[model samples]
Target: MPFMIGRAPVRRTLKYLESGKIVLKDQIKIFSINYNVGQGFKNKVHEGAQAFVFWTLPQLQYKNPDVQIVTFKNMTPSPFIRCYYEDGKQILIDIDSRSNDEIVNHLIKVIGKSKQVLKAEALAAEEKDNPANFGVGCARKCMCEIPGQIPCPGVCPLPKVMRGKYFYFKKDELENPEL
Candidate 1:
């Protein structure tokens, strides 16, 4: 079962947005800015991914206008969501869960308006704000998997999964999925 994302996290994230304290990224669509310092850390992988699509995605595309679509490793479809079962025991059907078809739709909706250009400095800033670095420990934590020491999600109150194993984004496929 996918873990639930509680309201407290959502409230905190909304508060940040209303207060204009968010980083205002323009690249990453289907997600929000509060996912960084909000209670997102407390959210589970499924919830976090859902948050990306449900909450963060629109805000980024509309507000930031600078967000880009890059890929990382372990973005999903791994230890948690692997082969499907008919009984629906281990199936993950979150918003961020994307297949080639959905990805294509997402691209048509979000990526079609390609006026913003990617700059080196902007890339660096995006890199700086990446979940693997100052944000959450998706990719880095995966690389630093210490067996029992799950990396603490920066501000959201969630604990990292697989401790040392990093969660990454499949760059090319990010915008290719549909909702």
Candidate 2:
């Protein structure tokens, strides 16, 4: 049976396979930036750090115009930046006690990464194997053969007539049937 996808908004992001292809697949649109830092202390080093981030913002924006920066202040005791890629992967770096140069270097390295890392490999198809053999043991049929029916424990399941019925036909009757 084919899987049916719902029409709800929450279920829209889910991927569905239909007719040997993917449907409603998720796509990476843009990269995002989120920064959450402490509120206290207005020292020169802090200002320089902020200036460094601001300076790097345009460089990232130039590379990806759709990139956005979100500020969340006083949320934590330390400072950290989170880079969320379109492939659902994220890179989080702690900069609570780092210098301006170190922070800039980290940001540059992250920005240099290609978007190819975000996408995962395609899913492969499953092989169909014969259920009876299934590479378990010998591939020969059962030796116990019954007339007008399959052998006991054959490669396939026996029908209802072979399972419960005791009516058996002779060799000549089986060769020339008039029913």
Candidate 3:
């Protein structure tokens, strides 16, 4: 007989953000989805996400198409979903779909992608609207420099990169977070 994992603790954080919210800042805006689901079950999906991080993360550096990366393997413990990535990135994502029927469509997977896409779109839009944001001749020069490890002059000493798995929801979708 196949054993079934009990879904009992899923109710603990009933009033958490599980979808989407965006906040804009002059230096940097954060588009995030917050999920504070079943906070603590360390299980198979969690293990899988870990494995993906270990095996895949090292190989992705300098990879184009997705300089910003996030990978999701599962959702466990009800409220919290499992995402795979390096440590230290601050993030929270929510897709806002009521039913999490399939693992592929889980909050982590969708919202993570949304964060990445929105970031790209924002940069593209900025570049498109303000040509002066670029160099004197529109030559490769831009008002701001790309973020990298070593800080460059006139650049943000620190840059905000999306990190961590967060729940997604529509505006006003989640109630005030239970303190």
Instruction: Give the CA lDDT, 0 to 100, for residue 3 in model 2.
Output: 32
Error of 2 at 163 (Å): 99
Residues forming the 10-long window of minimal summed lDDT in candidate 2: 16-25
Model 1 Cα lDDT, one tens digit per residue, 41-79? 333433444444444444334444554423233444421
Q: Name the regions of candidate 1 deviating beyond 4 angstroms.
A: 1-21, 24-44, 70-75, 78-179
Order by lDDT, highest first: 2, 1, 3
Cα displacement (Å) at residue 110, model 2: 3.6
Tell me the number of clashing residue pairs for each predicted model.
Answer: 37, 0, 23
**lDDT per prediction?**
0.38, 0.46, 0.36
Q: Higher lDDT: candidate 1 or 2?
A: 2
On lDDT, the leading prediction is: 2
Candidate 3 stretches with Cα past 4 Å from truth are 1-41, 64-179
* Candidate 2 lDDT, 55-115, residue by residue in tens: 4444444434455556655455456677666777776767656676677666545544333
